[model samples]
Target: MQSPTKPLAYSYIRMSTDIQLKGDSLRRQQQSSKAYADQNGLELAEAFKLEDIGVSAFKGANVSSGALGQFLALIKAGEIARGSYLLVESLDRISRQQVLDSIPVFFDIIKSGINVVTLADKHLYRAGETNFADIMYSVMVLGRAYEESKTKSMRVGAAWENKRKNAGTRKLTKVCPAWLSLQENRTGFDLIPERAEVVRQIFQLADTGNGSFSIARRLNQTAIPTFTKSNGWHESYVTKILNSRAVLGEFQPHRYDDHGDRVPYGEPVADYFPKIIEDDQFHRVQASRRRRLVEGAGRKGPEYRNLFTKIAKCEYCGAPMRFVHKGRPPKGSQALKCTNAVRGLGCESISWRYSDFETSFLYFVKEIDLTATLKAAAERSERATVEQQITVIEEKIRQLTAKRERIFELLTEPGSSTAFIKGKLDECEAAIATEGAQITKLREQRSMADMLPTISADELRSLIASVQDMSAPDIFERRAAVANRLSILVTSLRIAADGRRPKMKGIRTFLESQELNPDERDRLIDHIEKTNKQSQRYNRSFNVMLADGVSRYVVVKSDDPTDIIAEVLVDRDGAISGSDRGMPIGWSDGWDNVFDEPVSV
Candidate 1:
């Protein structure tokens, strides 16, 4: 009862670099903290083993988004006892920031009722103690630490800049892409054949419209060993490989900013690495990825049942039409239904038989000269526009390059501040890099314009003939390939049912305003219900638009399979010539007349 309990103490440890963790920095700090706690008769708490390994104090990263930040937040919230002691190796261990910025942080800890004990100096900064000498001593230590870090940063940056400047003469570092190995002399890199082949295969699969996940799964299923220390391939790694411009034999230099974030430092140097994927093929794969993103078809089933993946939409509500199966295999058929109607969101719930729609589409699509249509759709003016943009970006790059050269010239002048000139050079280089990136994008767009559907009209006709039988084993795969080709040709397929939405909103609002009796309200609701049910049992139609702005309307009657009507809408040139049969009277006026008689929904 006479012996008093020791006050609680927690240790805070941090290291600027991970290399120090491999050394004795961690053990040295831990031992010093434990020894200090023991000699001071304090209970060293094992619950909060705060550490910020490899975090930089120079940029205050350890205090923001690190373990130290979490500890400070807890202290402010009164979770930690007021008189608890915080043991660190030294003042610099807490922060290496400038004295002005770091002093406030040191005082913040002391003011919050925590004692900061520096093990290296054997000094205890007690809570509520405001010694001017102690404050000045801490400031001096922080200032010295900041100067050390700043000097180190400058030296490292200069070394890297030198390496980048001579990248063509020698390899920058031992670290190369997974598919390459740095030579023994460290002068160049050589590609590994097997890994390079795998890289090529990945790009080929992506260009064929396979997503990264699918490619990764395929590789894993085939038991292909990954480049890294992993059991199998991952979608993230596959995406990284696809996105890397390093495969094009170019290298972009980077540098860390004040915030410790890496940013592009200079213009990309071409032929820095061995070219793996061809430029045209790489740009084509990028275009395919962009199309997949816009179409929202990043993931798909192996079957790829629906040709109209993201192209199909409800004409009434503008919601996507989902492909679904109805019933079991022999008796079951695939159908497309409006997404909004399926969710019971006030849209007509008419179902379209996918088999019949596909058949009609294949037959009618043959009437149009696809080759001619595709050629017309490929606008030469668009390529000219991209060329113009590239010219403008090239001009900007020239100006920035000239400015950077002038800055280098000024560095040779007498009494010029080297740091100021270096800063100006960095800004100019960053601007040149940005402009170069814009030029690269414009060139990619130009390449994308050259990418047209690879399938010819005869090949398409033959494919259509081969898949005439719906029950064929490879029918799904064949149709999927056809769908991929059609995705490049067709822009949209808008489906409209024969039914019209009921206009009962005004009546309901008027009834609510009148404070009608329950009986009257029930009677009005019953009338609206009957009207909605009657309107739902009508035919479904689809409006398909080509890339060249040509459209075809197909009306499918559920009650009469033989009553299917396929008619081409008037083209932008006011010419209608897809079907051998002429357009019906009053149809030439437009879609308004086709659904003019609105049925109750």
Candidate 2:
């Protein structure tokens, strides 16, 4: 006859702190469970590995969101076989919750046809067997565990509270930012010069419109070692440094809640660390980041080619116009093509050479009076108006927060409906989120206003002149800097192409009116036909809208790449001016139609 198979037993192990793992906690528990299983003729269920590390059971967190909760759920669903053993080191491993609350969980397991074995005390609560002695023993053990955890939690909380009270005078812990180290006296922090300089360089790069990834790449290329143990710099760490207020010599105290999550507990203390960045520069970097968040952070590459990155759009299908390079110089050239056309989305595939557009735009933009443009923008978005709007939204958020607090108080009242209270809380939270988003948008607007370039008219003109110099060694860098400035000055650039061919009848009439022989007329006719064909290939226009509500309509007539012609039409305060001397006959008509339609910025 075959030997009888042994019963299966699943072991559960838990530790409130991972520090216990460094000692005999894990190994000791494993050995005890193995010994018990071997001695009782039970097979250890290695398949069911249940362990909760760094998980607290004082408030039943282990049973609520940990592996133990999953195991109990499996037992309740009748997945685990009847008469299986759940072996634990002690009752506290299951729960340290108050006896009134923990008794139900303790009894639920036994009632579900599983045996509970406490390896430490060698007690077994078998399935379908209830005894007064077992009940009393479990209650006493659970009660004692709850009291001990409660006392320890209170003591730790009190210690943290005291530390927070003295945070301004002394350092709270040895831990500090990577750029600084706690002093030996334990009263302050000292900055490491090399690391702090790197922090400053990060802020300076950000202020000039470099995003986190760009800054990290630049640092790595220069072989700048990171403050951490990592081999090289990373974008995430760069972003953390950019967003931390610790560089401004401030610290915010935090405390752990009952759920074991850290939350800010008090107002931030000032002058906690050595200041590495000034206030104006810090705010400027923040403003640049916010602007990049809205108007995308443009791509970084060897050549910062696209000046009109997120601002340029195709007038026909409202798709972005991307700058694309076909091949090497002898075979192909860089051009701007509508993304829709490239995707075969029902738009004409007209490629406008970027050289022609850049030259024409810079030549015309130099004629504009930037001082007047800045004044108009200031009038449109007054600082006072933005601040007033921010105040109103903040008040609305405060009222909603108060209302949510009132609803929370009702949760403790007798016979209160939990679902109703939850619904109210959720509604308040949604409203707060909406208002918070509005405030963020308004704040960004104010930041943009603050970040407007503060340079003299001559300096601005010099910058534009430098941007126009394509042969300069640092031309790409110069163009990128000017692009950032233009992003503030210009709101949008709407591009349109006129690919329709010139009328044959009109060409014939014009030729007949001219005094020429048959051969001459034939040659002229052929020339006109060729010009019209070329025009159909590359005749495009742009409607550039300035922040001051001023608009410039630039038409690039690139029938011949070597000798391209451009015309500018300015519309200032409803008055249209600018030379139409060499423009095509009906070019202004297209401009009028575009101006009449609603344009979303």
Candidate 3:
């Protein structure tokens, strides 16, 4: 295969990221080598470009370090080496930087019949050119260039750092994950609601009634995607979420002025931004979390009906009685004794038997015919009145849209005086604003419509039918009913009005129970709203993704909106399907929402 007339070989060009040099200014050298190859009309062979390499000769052609070494390994196997022609961009690009000083070692490269052509010293070398003198001269020049470039790189880096410091740029913009947001400051970040919720969720999970590990396990089970989805989850992420005080939406390291105001840099902002959540709500959720502590610690005694145990008021001190069980003789006996009452307050004969307390409460578990009640509620007369308003809103939105389109026309017309046109523009803008406000008001009404009770009997019947088809487990079904329509009222002793067992005061409504009357509906709504507010005021029901793919939602959980970007999707016929995506703005309007996914008219 060795033809005597054939040209010797080719060369390869490479650039390793030299820490001192700017982006490859080795263009002139590459041009020289190309010129040399072209002038000779040397049948060009292969050219391999080695990039991002730190050292050319020291590190033997390794591509990426991990998981990607297989490709480089194949190249090193030398599957194809019959060619005698090779092209290199420059000599320095091919040779080792440190080996240039060792002239004899540098000359050894041409021994394999591979010529080295470098533009730095403009040396063209074949087997004979690899002598001691040529190697010594070429190495001396290339070494100087390398050291010089490194010096310039150090100077440039220092200048950039120094300029920023002098310009008073102290704060490095921080990418605070959810549970915190950052604002521009000379120093650094301010917490926003987006991140606060994450913080609260973390702490609440740690302090849950079910314990922290159980919370972590549950979170791990859900494939809750974290901020960095590609990296997966970790326990440290979970622990960080729980322990960080950033949940309160306050920078713990920051301080308020003497006037107790947050100087967002210089100006104090009095809750100008949407806060993460209140401290009271977060603390309450944490308090509810049963922590395993040593003996003599305040431990809540189990109650037959402990739902409202320490939370309800006491008769003696007028303060709430702490629920507790004394050991031995009263091991299984659950009692509510007033703490303030013992501290010398009021009536002592206020306690009732735990046996009698929950015995009368068994009616709470009574199952109502959901089909009948929901059917009646959904078909109520009020919904019929509300249905007629949709057409009115549609007509109004159409007119507003037409008016919005005319603003450009009025402003762009020729021969219009500035003052006259300005007035017209202002009038149009005012009208647009009015229309926008009206549209917003209507949209809010539409959203609030779902919050309204199902007064329509027929719709309730439909909902019941749908519910029957839903495969919610027994516990889920019971909780869902409670979430939608149940309320509890607890009081001691029933007041009899005229005769046998007074009809209104003593019992609680719960589980699958419904309002027996219009009055009860109002009462139920009040309690539902009250509980909702309480959940928000005191709970941290946000989630976090740990490094281990575990997801936890802890602290003060409300079933309302979970995140700011959350949406509430509604069909034209007024049934809410739920959120489609987390859109920062409103949902995109399309006819597909109406035609493709039509709701029950």
Candidate 4:
């Protein structure tokens, strides 16, 4: 009645890369599958090892390549063993799609008078016993997971665009020429008080007849270095700084986004960060360009232009005021000011100092009436939003009505043919059908709206402020501020010395007015910290791969990779050295004392 069942079987193994074999990835796994066979009194025979196969799972992980196909082919022909058993080290190691297609294969294997054994999952098959509901549930879960992944991808893309569009004013809090981060929200910048002093000295130098070249030479004589640490400063670099809006006292947002796009610039941060010189010092540089024989042909300003460039309109002309630099001011000094002042567009090139702008900026950044503006914006948003929905419904009705009228006109046209009239009527009929459905949807929306109660002022303000200042936060904070009600306005940039406030526009003015709740901020910080840490590991791993000075190949490390194998190809000049936090916080003591081993790159 039982001739020991002869227990026919085969071994299966896979390794993602050639190097994985050397790491004994397959070798290390075979032993476990073998052990499962030995314990079950089954004999392992032939082996099928698939290497360098490119199909990715990351979903259902309990599949064996060729096993099902071969088994099905054999079973249909009545060729496979009557009581054979299949052996593997568990499912996930074999495939990514664990539950979906695997269970059916398991059913097939059992149908062929076979049972299954797994090493890690400890799965053992008893003939005729299968879990259909569980498998169906798994399918549903996987389906839901896939849907979620798609939704999250779309949401992430949309959020990034939103941040880029609204963050046009983020840079005012960003790193300054002297490395300062002026916003109360930001934690660090390259700014040094001493370096800032040196920049001030540069403006002062240019204010005198010492041209940019002369100023650069004078600067090189001192201990300070340009951003790149060159010995002699260049006129090009000097000109850039004098013309930069940071010196004119404004923070710009949306310098860059997760995906590449030159984000729309932001409004000047209300007087928060300091300016290195007066607006006139910048203007002199501009005038110098115009008065020169070349009409500012070779002149190039700093790359970090403030986001407020076009937002501030010339109040007199009601056109966007342009920032301009002049080399010769009324006082024979360099200055920064609006370009339109003289073009009969507004006023003449008024010379100014980075210092004066910086001082005035401090006041502006500090003085936005956050509460009043936010409340007003909240009201406007509610009104506009509801009205916008109303307009969509009305617009559709009008379109359908227009088509209906056109059909009537076609039927009545003096020489119209019957076929022509019929065609028009058919089109009109189809449009009317679509409009009926749309009208039903709109009625449902309106009914839902009618059922809802209006929010109180405090509640409405809270809702609006929650999404207020979304653009300026860095990668970490920004990711967590996922639910943004962000808005920005770049309406008025430069103001008189005694100007008391920064006029708000868009959503920013509203958020600035509302009182900030620390709890929400902390939640955002936590999410940012977690995600940034993981993303940083990938980035640094990519960098370490660069250090290898080799080609890119798939690599798998066993004992916690010292670094990612792909980063070996990059260099210091490569932008995006890594995630913002390239180096681990506790991995090294400091830049001064770390890496004393004289490592060669």
Candidate 5:
């Protein structure tokens, strides 16, 4: 009788630490697996080594993006031949995850018709042939591995706590302040002469009445290298150096929040290292900063200077129109003047007085005809619906393309009959052609849906009423409120000195920018939500991450029941066309009319 052909084999290896990878651990695992495969009449497949270095098996790393996941993906894609052998050093190497999680993953590999060979235990596990004893043994081994990992985690946590408590007394950690050097014994800090001198110079400049900007410019002129990797000095960097307590020989521990803002963790250790700046000089710098804050220098105002700073540009020189407060105290007038004009440049654009601009802009904002905006929004809504249909057709086209490629591949195989190959190829090509035509038709419909559509008179009036009172007593508050409204409803405003008042260009630009086309599902997911939960179907306000990378809040009424979505409020006003929504209805771009229920048209 002919001997059974040697089963194809693949090896998997993993190490959870740099030390294990650097040592002979990986080598030993490979050697053992190879020996087992040789002895068991299994041929190790070509270029089949899988290694996940410094990845914790106990953390379900294998089930995610690791080598194990790639192995499973290959099996599902039919890249790996059925009835192959998967060789590993042991069960723990496969995964140290809990039995509940790891057992299922093991079963998945086995069910793919691959036999698992654990070299350490000399046990071979086949998918369909597993008995009660085999399962119990696997679970026992996985449980031990999990418990081992848990024990190690607790020990590491305890060690870290002890280190943190004794931090100040010990030498400085791996990374030290640029102005200080780690001690020879690797504990505490020692001043670096060169960097410490730069710290002293920064304090000296601040003490001599030089502002952060002036100091930064002077340092840059002298070619002074900044702290860390930055090549040159900046005003912000100068300010940070002046504010740091490290110059005064203090050690402060800080932790970062989810948003990456720094938060102090514990009380600072005073005199932790040799001082670079005197306590007297440090106190004087602090006083200077406080005095500057009181004098309106580099200080956050009670409000923003104007509603439009970078938004309003000079019609002549194109310089930004900045808000300036002039005259004495209460009589000071707020105006938007071109920066180039103020800086002695020959910008011919006339400065607009804030009061006059506000009066004219408000009047124009009140008179905004939402007719065009409403039509544009309706068109966008229609486009979004058609885009979703296009997405389905595109997916079908992808499948058909793959099928056609597979037919071509099969035709190249030896002994394939010409008649049979031609018949299969013709079938695949026909299906591909049909799907391609469908995609073309869907795209054409999407292009037509892109045309503007109008909203009803009642909806237009409702949108107009929302911005009628865009005024506040505080200049900063007024600008903020007005800017928010104008950014959504008004695209541009210009007040020409030739006698024309400030006029709004309309909300068409704003609406068109916020439009969505759901032709590609991957791209659409960024803007569209399929489920009610993802759509924030509740009264509570929630934020959505738009395709443009802007996170806009969908404000809902607070009093409504959380179970149902009453109305979707967007921008300053929650008009249907005011914000874009994905499809459930026909392709029409414009503000969606609310009739007890949102029905797509």
Candidate 6:
């Protein structure tokens, strides 16, 4: 039953991705819409033709921000006359959103005095129509579309699982690890010599008990190249390489959800990829890694037991500074040396004496007054109220900006009518203006708070005192427990090469507001910081004995903070001498020999 007088029709076309452009999908859709218009004797509205390519209907992108939004905008503006036909290839071509979400959009279209026509089924539903048949039919069609999408998704998952299972029996046809390439026959992988050697070196370092951070520093020091240009020889990359089973010739396949979180898809296939390192070497590296790495409340190793092991970094190359103890027992000498610099890895950082740095640090600590620091902290807390308000306003501005972008995307869509675009643009612009004004007000308030008085000398004194009291009672204890406590209170402590004194930053504000002598509470905070930034404990015990047949106890201080007790003797002339009475004057264990064996905490 054809209407004698045909109405003007607006054709809507959609495709999921631009890859479909390679096919005749666009041409076929256009041809169908045109044929239907001719057969029905409807006048096609050329200006109203809407096509949304590379968009997904299953995600409701259709109604939310694509051609559908623009079409609605046109209808609202009365750009398309009432009783005009809206043509699509099929119902699913319009939407694949779940029935509930899709039905409302269909209703709105019909409510706008437009008639929706599905060419394939030749079903026509008019504006202002409230018939049960039309509603139920639309629901059934949209539901089927939604269900079809879900079914496809499940099939994709199953297909990937099958491919992964096949991967276990056959080598990968394409795609290979950075260190490997396909062989001549394209059946197996062969090592990319230079890259393979790099992998070998990485395992070699890990085998010798060097952690990922140290390994990264070593690679950077040697000017070794990396596979990617974006992040060259990063600690995270080194860690990932060491953790991956691919080093041992295993392929682990995984699936990702919509949000990109990995899900286990299949069992790992050993020997699926060509091996880079020997199995024994790979397992040994893993063992070494396990022994050096510590996770929260998990296994820990003695290698990372020192309080200042990795914390005190060399300013020259940013490499970790380690304690270098000189001489055997009874002859004390030590310095904080950069391990990389000592190895002649091109770092020019200088070593520091443990005794000198510790003395200066203690001197600084003794001068702090806790009472004034607390008052300053309270003042800071008061300023935080304004800061909190500013943060809230800034977050609102960010959200509004995102909303504006989404609205602009809809307005710029191919199907957007000029009147609808004008209306939405005006609304979004007003909202943005209001948000900008609020942000400006908050910024001004924040600037005012920033002008508050600085931390007073008395407060600094209190901070230093608080840090000292929290230190371990055993001065001879391997852990520089006191220094670790101080590090927690500040963001960073940079020690200059010749200066030796640490310049601190970002003294935590809460320390000032705490009740005087807040005992366990302060300790708890220090404990938490310590766990997160676990430093290696060094051997701090050193001894010096006075001569004259009467042994006088003396503590020989050095810049090195390793736990080894270096015993030395002092003469009546106040000259420090070693206990090698029978040996030559220069006979002693040198500093170079200290690191011959691994230095575990």
Q: What value of lDDT does candidate 2 attain over all alpha carbons?
A: 0.74
Poorest stretch of ten by lDDT in candidate 2? 592-601
Per-residue lDDT of model 2, residues 1-601, tens digit only: 9997778899999988777999999999999999999999999998788998878888788899989999999998989888999999999999998888898999999999999999998889998788989888889999999898888866775676578678767778887889998988888898899999999999988865688998999999999999878988899999999978789887866654334566554345678788899865665566557667996776655357777777788876789988888864668788878898989887768767776666556546643444344444444335646765676577668656866776786564334569977987898899999999999999888644233455664566554555555565555555555566677878878777543332444567888888879799988888766655543323566778888778877655555322334444555646555534233324445544432221221
Q: In candidate 4, what are the lDDT values of residues 1-601, reduced to their tens digit?
A: 8676557666655433244556756765677767767777777765544222332233322133333344556656887566666665654333433345544554566666766656557666544456676445435544554455346545754564455444444432244555464556543233467767777887776544356776787787775666666656788988777656676556544432212234423233434356556654555544443344352232222222222343433322344445454443455433234455546553534333432332222212312233334444444444543434444445545545655665564443223468956776787678767767765765555321222344554554443334333342232122222211111322234332111111212234454456767676556555544443333322211001222232211111223222222121123343222112234222233323321222222
For model 2, state the Cα shift of residue 258 in Å: 6.3
Question: What is the Å distance of residue 207 in model 5 from its true position?
Answer: 15
TM-score, model 2 to reference: 0.62
- The local distance difference test score of each candidate is 0.73, 0.74, 0.40, 0.44, 0.60, 0.60
Looking at model 3, report the run of 10 residues with the lowest lDDT sum. 495-504
Model 2: residues with Cα > 4 Å off, grouped in runs: 2-5, 168-170, 252-270, 278-295, 299-307, 310-355, 358-555, 558-601
RMSD of each: 11.6, 11.3, 30.4, 34.5, 27.3, 24.2
**Candidate maximizing lDDT:** 2
- Report the Cα lDDT for candidate 5: 0.60
Show where candidate 5 strays beyond 4 Å.
1-8, 18-51, 64-81, 99-104, 119-123, 131-140, 172-175, 184-187, 191-221, 226-601
Q: Write down the TM-score for model 6.
A: 0.38
Off by over 4 Å in 3: 1-11, 17-86, 95-105, 119-122, 130-133, 152-169, 172-186, 199-601
Q: Which digits, one per residue and each the tens of the lDDT, describe model 3 over residues 140-231?
A: 75565445444544565355335434433343235344644456563444554433544456555553333445555555676545545545
Write the residue-wise lDDT of candidate 5 on 357-429 in tens digits. Answer: 5433332233233444334434545465465455555655654576566556545433345796688678767
TM per candidate? 0.58, 0.62, 0.28, 0.22, 0.39, 0.38
Candidate 1 wrong stretches, greater than 4 Å: 2-5, 73-80, 130-133, 217-232, 252-270, 278-284, 298-305, 309-356, 361-601
Ranking by lDDT: 2, 1, 5, 6, 4, 3
lDDT of 2 at 126: 90
